[model samples]
Target: MPRTQVTGRTGPRRALTVLLPLLLATGTPLSVGVPASAAEPGAVRLPVMPSRLAAGASCTSASHEVATATPWEQRSLELPKVWPSGSGAGVKVAVVDTGVSQQARALAGRVTAVGGATADQDCVGHGSFVAGLIAAAPVKGVHFAGVAQQAAILAVRGTDDRGVATDTTVAGGIRAAVDAGARIIEVSPALADRSRTLTAAVSYAAGHDALIVAAAVPDATTTTMSTDTPPRSYWPADEAGVLSVVAVDAEGQAPQGSPAPRHADLAAPGAGVIGIGPGGTGHFIGSGASLAAGYVAGMAALVRAADPELTAAETANRLTTTAYPADVPRLDPYAALTSVPDTATHGEKPAEEAVRLPEQHTDAGTTRRALLVAGGGGALLLLVVWASAVVPRGRARGWRAAARNRPTGTS
Candidate 1:
């Protein structure tokens, strides 16, 4: 899908503005996705939150080198293959979390903070890290690349420097992000309860064809007290139209000791991820469902940049339908970018093959069948050659035996 179509909200979007407020008072306060036990009941954010390697690391240079940076997450997301089509240029992605720093190297010239939280400042650092994962400009030789390098970041600070914010504040942040022309809004916080204002904000964003990606489901085994309360589930993500992302580790399996994400609409690498820090060229390491959500948002931006005509829901459907693993449809940016069906042939009823995944991104079945065909052909050729050589040898041996027995007396 190339960036040719103009996107506008569908008919249902007009109704969301009317229908959203009704939901405001209906939902309860279980909006925090982070297990209260794992993280204090604060900003409802990603589950794969990373720990700081060095809180006091210096950032005196133009580009900071995080020696302990892990590129595995980027590789697993297959970013290298996805960059050529579009680096999310012309798409606005809102990072509605802690404020993003104006001075960060990766986002130096590309960030704009909306509303009145902190102007381009991520003192808590979570928002900066998440922003880096989404759109950090590539620095050669540093092994650093964001999912959508050219995507601009609209930093909407819903949380404070302590990584804490009231639901109302976060909800306002969401609304501001929508007004800032964000095509994709990445809400990184979880809440202990649903805020009607927040739900309304999310609804408002959807009304504009803006896709909201959030991590709303907590692991089933996540607990608050020793009494074993269920894992946290939050708003926006739990809301009707949001795309919920779940965290997977380097192995693409459930992270150790964490509860399995049962309600996740998709999964991504969230553990041990490295991201850009707010102050300098340095970096911070944290993993959580937030990282995965950010990655999905960045990918969504790519889809928008590649084809701006797709509606938010259609965009989301494309993501889920085109994702790999078939079962979970894990985010696959390359396939999403290159697997566009020809518009001339894309009518109401098109051939399945014509609309199917790009040949380069075929499933394992295709490769396995190819291997089987090649192996069968090789085995048949080997059998034919063996028969040709062995039959003649057997005949000659038989003739020699007969001559040895009869010719001695006859001669």
Candidate 2:
């Protein structure tokens, strides 16, 4: 796919407004074209499998860099200082991307498929790479480890083998991750276009108080001719309540193709970042905005583990505000673990009382919509599923927020 200049959209999310109307009127399904660097099984070089398996094989020597590569990488982000307090224990980060490989050593027994079935397996290797960045176990002989070494991975496959997924599939993946008890969701695709399905899914996750960490720009792109018609933008990342992440190098400089400063919430080291790869590649170099997003997701996990009582937005706010610069913050795992949370509780007093936001939908209208959804057929099925599944979760989140903020004496 050729790199296109920005159109009126000015970011990666162009033509979404146009894509939504076409989906509803013509019922045409638009597919997401994941960047080749992020997807394509044949394109990704898997590690050479060992003839005989050892107890804890990591293949550390296969790496092109020195053994100290990973330690330096972690030090750049200041991750060591926070590991003792919270290695993301008791946190589940939903990875929405290519499926995760079950046999990746760093992720052995750590990955959970979203559905009850034996799915969420990765063929293209991208999802496994992303998963390792968030929560891989420490390799026996290598200096490498995930940012949130103890966090569990909720693997949800949105894209197919070719790294192509429809907006509907991506949306469903987000909802599934939330329902599967993921506290932090890592959306690894930077889709070429946008859809109502994806927007609704984003809202559903936010309403349920789940933090969304999304990859932006080059890691996600459109293979269609419309990609030539820019203001280039990437979806889900551009959506509200989602943390947009960009890739930086060890020097902390954002790359050329990443989301502009205005579009990104944080940056993390992605250039030459070492990650355990799919099909037992042990640990290798991976780079992109997707990897950067994975780092942020891991940080969110650490923050949530420090205090599972935090709301999604509250957790995200802590990470963003305490970053290295505080403004356009860079990922600072140490600060996320040590800093005071915005919603900290002390002596039974509430800090700033939460103002109740208006309900997403009035009761009568919701009931009417539910009835219509049940009565309708074909295309309406997706909407009906969302109503049945996401609505209740949203309501439960609201109640939880209310109870957390309820006055000490008032009934």
Candidate 3:
């Protein structure tokens, strides 16, 4: 798939202008700053989830690396299922987050920094943690490498230590990954609303047959009992053409009882998950849906590796349909690639065909001709789905805004 540039302000001033009054009327902060909007008391915040990779002591002769031999090895992490042979070895998984530490032993030769966005330096160790979870190499003592150590990674820094991400930077990172030919895009950060730039960027990536995965809102009741505000909703997850993932415990249980939306595609091991830390020294117990999303992304790489012809949507559906629901369905990596139905299909209940071609063509560029031709149809279909949800709500809000500004005095 060819890369296309996405343009447009994510949060328009007019909409925010109108929404601000209502927010203030409800006793919420309406300040013109992002932090202020985020800092409002009881305002729900996205979980600072990290996909901890390798953090345990290395047993290798190498000094900085963890000692390969340790008691942790005996009791260390185990793959939920056997790593599928010939799974996602050559495919690339793009990590869109804080940034990665290029010096880490497991990812030394595998990390590619997106120019102008973030170098291989990770100030807060967040990006490195996410990267390790997706494709960390096997340590001499540590038995479990990541889900796909053979997969390459493109690290696009979307946030820093302070935990902030602007839509513009994130959108640029998405376009950069698609332009560079990324097969699976892992977006750990969540946007607050369905902004134009984010929605378009997702469509643009999906048009190119790139699978986009992101974190869902955290389980409010399970972890924290904050009631100052309503439970937060995650964007990109809520948007069309993207798969939203929620986290589950080691026992394969969702964090909260909150039912996932129709868009909630899959669940992965999330709570108390361990992975590599900065400098490749030791491991840490990370929590939240971020790691779960990474696990799904790695599994997605394997799906793409197994069948290069499968579209992103198809890959997602395979994962979703085959997922084992522990109450809610959790991703089952092996079943996604190998499972097939045993029934006839003359006019039976049509199995949910995952890949639907696009309906319109917007000139992203000419370089990705093969991708454009094959994936454009599916891309257009996703666009229609996106429009159905966004356009009507926008028109209704516009009318409401106009009414709010109209002169009320009798003429």
Candidate 4:
């Protein structure tokens, strides 16, 4: 089998425009002005963490540079608006990667190593960075935080200490995560070849009601290859019962030379992404499909926490169905949490039970604001009338929008 090395590139951050309305509607605090920390003199600079190390490379060092600006993904995902309803509480997400470090301060007291104590040691720092992207807690004065701050992490080593992954190790990691009762298993390795064992592992996870999230392509390639190399499938991403994720930048564009996967279920903020490394208050910059998978897994945790009754398949469906329409749908975490599924499209009769928000979690004012946001300040009655007329027509047309029909692009 032929292999191509994937590379990481940093892109300029663009401010997200659509989230402000939702944030105001939810009463989530927004920091419009620059923080005092950004102006401080002699701030420590952060390093870029490597996805893998070459032979004889020294172990990754801890970063001391703290990030003060909020990551673009935070604003793009509208995390603040969704945090009030679901903080991924009680959800167990497995990070099947190099390993997750116990020394990461934000992930302290939340990570459980699956294979052994060695599984808690992240020499490459890739696993620890992915874990931070999923569940790192809020730190005072730092704007960077995980998507699911309250979710528990199950660290399983799918790669060796130097960050090389094999199908056997990755297969075992998936099974281990399933056996550990993880609600969501995030597979960071994007192996070049598929294996029966890995396919079976994905099946086993689905059998046990675990949602498996995987990177659509390798984060970093080991050797240089031509940019025109045709796209290929990687596993267990190519396997059934998996949600394959690709990385996109703040501008919703994939990095140059990114391998286009045959079947990417979602695109997330992955390029030029900021995260914490092992044993650090500081942050590191990383990019690729693996990091994108982390974001999807965190969003899955939130959906599972928000609606505990949703099955693994149902949860995956909810995420894809509510995603912002695109060639490969862009993840909209807020929509995944709040939007009701369109069951009629699934050929199932609509349930008679009314969908109700938990009053204990949402006040009357918040509810009114949400309604206003949905209706664009029009009367709720008018919105309902519009939906009644348009929804049936949308269903008749198979819900195919003009955007979805456009030429497919990478990420």
Q: Write the per-residue lDDT of candidate 2 for residues 233-302, one digit (tens) a residue.
A: 6788888899988776544544333344336778787644667656554454545678889899998998
Off by over 4 Å in 2: 1-68, 115-120, 220-232, 256-262, 343-411
Candidate 3 yields a Cα-based lDDT of 0.61
Q: What's the lDDT for residue 131 in model 2? A: 87
Prediction-by-prediction clash tally: 19, 12, 28, 2
Which has the higher TM-score value, candidate number 2 or candidate number 4?
4
List ranges where model 4 is wrong by over 4 Å: 1-44, 116-120, 222-226, 341-411
Which candidate's TM-score is highest?
4
Q: Summarize candidate 1's per-residue lDDT along 367-386 as a digit string, tens digits.
A: 78878999999999999999
Displacement of the residue 273 alpha carbon in candidate 3, Å: 0.5
User: Any idea what lDDT model 1 has?
Assistant: 0.66
Off by over 4 Å in 1: 1-65, 68-70, 218-232, 257-262, 341-411
Model 1 scores a TM of: 0.66
| Cα lDDT tens digits for candidate 4, 228-266 | 556789899988889999987767766544567777888
Candidate 4: residue pairs that collide: 5-221, 6-221
The lDDT values for all models are 0.66, 0.66, 0.61, 0.79
Instruction: Score candidate 4 by lDDT.
Output: 0.79
Highest lDDT among the candidates is held by which one? 4
* Deviating ranges (above 4 Å) for candidate 3: 1-81, 218-225, 228-232, 256-263, 340-411
Which residue window of length 10 is worst by lDDT in model 2?
45-54
